[model samples]
Target: MQAYRIDGVVRQGKTNQDFCIDLVAENEDQVREKVYSNFGSRHGAKRRYITINSITTIDPSESSAPVVVSHFRDK
Candidate 1:
């Protein structure tokens, strides 16, 4: 598994909110899909309403997320 930092905006009504999240995935494509699915289910935002600004690969040692930390720690 790889850790990724995804930065983007999610459309909510007339405004867009900035979001930066970390996720574990095999590749960028999977990460992108996860973002859309997550926002869709959690925030009621559609795929078209999400804009991905950047996708950065994060070194395991640099990740502060507990999910990322625990995942790599257990490996």
Candidate 2:
């Protein structure tokens, strides 16, 4: 697993940082297992304001570098 530093601006230009997680497993099942075992809480009780910072891969065939995937605000 790897951690990414997600920097963004909130309302009123307040800076915030979020920890974006990325990992590669042997298969889809392993990915699910890891995410569930570790990030199930964050996934289950969705609070919004979640965002992705980057998604770099160890493989060299990627066309572009990792970028933001999504962003939201908690109500």
Local distance difference test, each candidate? 0.93, 0.36
On residues 1-75, what C-alpha lDDT tens digit does candidate 2 reach at each position? 322232222221244444444454455445445444543364342223333333344432221223212211110
Off by over 4 Å in 1: none
- The sequence of per-residue lDDT tens digits that candidate 1 reaches over residues 6-56 is 999999999989999998999999999999999999999999999999999
Clashes of 2: 0
In model 1, which range of ten residues has the least summed lDDT?
66-75
- Candidate 2: residue 61 Cα off by (Å): 9.3
Per-prediction TM-score: 0.91, 0.29
In the predicted model 2, the residue pairs found to clash are none
Candidate 2 segments exceeding 4 Å error: 1-20, 40-75
Stretch of 10 with least lDDT, candidate 2? 66-75
Task: Output the TM-score of candidate 1.
Answer: 0.91
